[model samples]
Target: MLEQGRIGTRQLSILIFMMVVGDMMLIYPSVITSYAKQDAWICALVGVPLGMALMLMFLKLSSLYPEENLIQILRSILGFWPGNVVSVFYLFFFAIGASTHTREVGDFLTSQIFQYTPVRVIILMFVITIGWGLYHGLETIGRSSELLMPILIVFILVLAFCLLPQVDPSNVKPASDVGVVPILQGILISIIYPVGELIPIMMIIPYTLKQAHRTRDVLVAAGLGNLLLAILVTISLLVLGAFLTQHNIYASFVLSQKINIGGFFERIEAIMASSWLISTYVKAMVYLYAFTVGCAELFKLKQYRILILPVSLLIFGLSNLVSPNLTFIVITVVPYWIDWDTTLSIILPGLLLLVHMFKKRWKTKSSG
Candidate 1:
């Protein structure tokens, strides 16, 4: 109803793709190696189907109310009072995620590239950039993704291909060393990260040009992303081996380091890092945009862009305060904490869908 005119379905799909593919550059390897051991790649491969299905479910739920974003739909289905409560909770989840994701990216940059810079400064720069994008709204963000995705993909693939010679294939031995249980555990965890996390995409379904195909588009984009991640994870394992891949904080980075093209090309991790950085940047923009737009819709604000600065500042502060040190981040925050964090996103919307469906059935029966 409110004409934000920020983005359309094609751009929306690009944002989703960026969000899904972006973070894999950093966290995917670590999550996979945690349980799967030498079979970490296998865990990624196994988890993809489940992740795709979960994403599809999210797409379907959102499609039921094509004209309403999740926030609007929730309010409509549940009534203003209860729906507002749900909206508040969902907003909290999304806001915290935005801050945490911001902090994670900042921490990575400070550690890997800008060793002397303060985390706050690095984070502020990110917040400012993302804030600008969010202010422009989702359509601009989506178009930006479309422009950036190809270059990002090319760099990622080139780096992976360069490292192909290093892949021993033998490194992935004793297929069941960690056993299926651990692998499944890893897959379970992996499913929630970027895959199941697409639940937030529902907030933008109202902007989709092809409303009838919204579910299919989200599923296809999500599936493509998971397939790419699976391939990247598998290649990283094959080239770097399980032990090295696990030890390396950024396994993909390490894999990039292993590349030596014709003895002429070397130390190309910088290129890989740059490409991954773009992906993360795009991902952050999408989340920030959604948060702003959702708030605008909730309060019926004249312009969502007004909140971008204040929200960015809030996110900047929270990102800094989320953890004591990067170790606290890698070992505890991401590995253990995020599991509980993602559960709300998956379960809450699902419950809402069921509730809405039941309400429709009951009303139909009563009228009959």
Candidate 2:
């Protein structure tokens, strides 16, 4: 009940789409190709349906409590004490998500774009605007997403086609050269990061306009986003070759660097960076939204916005503490990111839904 505004189905669609593409586009292809190699796009192509299936796990759970955000739903189903405990873990997930993403933007800027600036200053600067967005509430955030989604899509489409001339077909050739097992393994990463991470959307569900078809809207939107991601991965592999795509920390950005039309139009990677920042901003707001709202609900506060600054500060502190540098994130956090996402997003929500179902059956039997 902390949210007074309701976002329309279209807004819901846009939010979910960005949520799918958000950070995954920057990082997923590299990790997948390291496993699937030349067949990474295959993993992306095949993971769509499977990813949507995983998305349904949270969507269905959200549908059951159209009025309650994920926090209240947790307490409603899992009892007072246990629910609070599990809820804290979800808060950690959201907090880490927001923090890590803030750090990612900072990392990319300091290392790739700004070379001279300190990472902490960049993070501090960005989090300030994020705090402003959080204060304006969900409707504002939703509208921002609605406005940005088209620009982001246009940027992506331009990036894709401009690089097509540079792409070598042989790079992604020998399809399934890694065989089915590794491709299947790559599908797991594909599903978990881009799709399973839809978990945090649970926080925003209550504010979305209630509709029987809302789930379908989410799935379709997310499915579109997933397909776009697959295309990008394929494009990356084709242009950068499997080795660079596999080795580059941010392959999509490097892939963007390849764009040139008769050498007249080039170095548009800044535009790519802009589009990424837009999508990342949307996704980071969701994480910050989840973090703040979860705290407000947990402590039983009247307004969630009041907690935004403190929590943003907390996230900023944790962002630095989360890892020493991008190298540490690449080595340790990237591997474990899927694990943490799996627990809160997929495994725990699935279990909660089952328990809710079992309790309903028990009540029916008892009443009879």
Candidate 3:
């Protein structure tokens, strides 16, 4: 194996949790609320179990080829040349995912905090950090996630408590008044995001130390992560009201800005920013790792670490050119991004699973 480092199910769960909650806190409320209105939280709540069910299929796929990543699975199920062709599609998918994630970090830092700094500079710094993480390997990233997980949990608790005073129960009133169709629309998005995008982790899932409880731990972690997201969406609606939450680009960030206890603890929106940074950092790092691993496997390289620098450089350029600005992301990319997620994460995985089962049965009959 190119990656020799091994992590337990615990670290893997933390990584998944981080991936699930990452950028959604910043942007999801606005979009979901626009569809389901106040019942956006309802959609999120409904999404938790559905997302877990989806995750189960992914886990089952990984177990089907316990020693192989998705690229190898594709090759095994499909033939050598055909599998490589399909794998190329994943290579492009991972590359685009890495670029978009890097751009998100850069965009948030420059637009919200460092108005004077060039986005290129911020992106450069972020890319360098990711490269450093990649050079060290997956174990380093997993251990770091274990450390960050507690801090992330603290941030979540503080956020919930600090914003409680501002919550208005009436805001979420008239539940589902927008009708079942809109709520269903909101649910579809809730699944597409965070959950649907989990396909990249198939690359790293093989690195995890197997245990009887591996699947349970990871699913529980996802459930915990999505439940917190639902709570935050509810809080955003309650504090900002459905209309404002729907229109505001960063409703959770704005929610944090409202935190005040006798004026001493005011202006701690930075906490929310810090939380976002930790989560996005993990998610972006995983996508980059997947891309690098795919490149190494495609070419039959000895190790993936050597390709990190050039791949990082390519992604740096792509990040700047991915879209013109945040408006493009909000207005144009957000809609299509879900479709992209559906294709790569859902459609592809399901296809592979079907072919794998049919081939297994055929081989059994042949041997008989």
Candidate 4:
């Protein structure tokens, strides 16, 4: 069986919430606004159902084999060689995801906060911090989430409220003026990101303390997280408008900079920065933990900690090498990442689910 590290339903829910809304708060607004324009919030709202559907797919697969992770489920259903092939692909996907997040953190810090700091320095520092968390295992991570998620939520709320006075409702006017096609495209893009990124949760679901309500918790957490994201997108549009929101690399950060309370409370971008760092940190931790666990299972190793440093080094190198700079990374990933993420998170596991059902039906008929 997988190493026995269990988390309660509440912890699992918080982790899911953090993972979905983490990097999204930083990157999604600009991308979505570039396409959906004034209708970006509507596009985000529409994506919630798609996010729910994705979560259900994960729930269905995990429920079928409640005690096994995605890697082990593949091995059981697809046999050794095929399963190993698929598992390696998953490891690569997780590695790419981790690297992307590392780059995101490094880029955000370098560009927005610590302009003088080297990107490598920021990346290395983040990797080591998360790697230490990974070494302690998922339970510790869960506990950390339980503690930190509340503070992050409060910070987000404060940031949002502080910006409310500056929001110009006219900025979000001319709703859906872009027509359905662009809005639909925005929905698709949004789903691929924070929504589909929940795929990593598959590696964690089997360790939930309560199995019966696991799917319910997943759906609830997803709904709440998507709601939060939709609100953030709306706020971004209201504060920055379409053209500025689209052109600004970190639009939400820009929004946070607008927060001023009577000249006494100013320069609150630090809160935004901290929120992004903390949430993204949680997200990176989840991906790295999943990658480590998947690797240990693939090699039949008893301990995943042994592989953490080497894998982290690989991810660190890849983070630097992924693209020449943040511009290139965003330009490349925003368009093509959907194809890769969908196939792994949805298509393959979905196909396996169909096969499992068919096999069960055939066996039943034969016995009859």
Per-residue lDDT tens digits of candidate 2, residues 1-368? Answer: 88887888889889999989997778877888888999999899999998889888878898788788888999999988899999999888889899989999999889999999999999998898888998998999999999899988998899888887787899988887787789877898888888887777888888887666887888899889999999989998998889999899799999888777887888988988888898888899889998899999999998887898789899889878887898898889887887887787778888998999999999999999
* Alpha carbon deviation, residue 44, candidate 3 (Å): 0.0
lDDT of 1 by residue, 228-344 (tens): 788877887788777877777788887777777778888887888777878888877766666777788889887776787888988888888887677887787767655654666
Q: Which lDDT tens digits does candidate 3 get at residues 41-160? A: 999999999889888989999999899998898898898999999999988988888898889888888899998999999999999998898898999999999998788789878988
Worst 10 residues of 4 by lDDT: 209-218
The TM-scores, one per candidate, come to 0.94, 0.97, 0.97, 0.96
Q: Global lDDT for candidate 2?
A: 0.87
lDDT of each: 0.76, 0.87, 0.89, 0.87
What is the TM-score of candidate 1?
A: 0.94
Tell me the alpha-carbon RMSD of every candidate.
1.9, 1.2, 1.2, 1.4
Give residue 341's error in model 2 in angstroms. Answer: 1.3
In candidate 3, stretches whose alpha carbon ends up further than 4 angstroms from where it belongs are none
Q: In candidate 3, what residue range of length 10 has the lowest lDDT sum?
A: 189-198
Angstrom error at residue 178, model 1 = 1.6
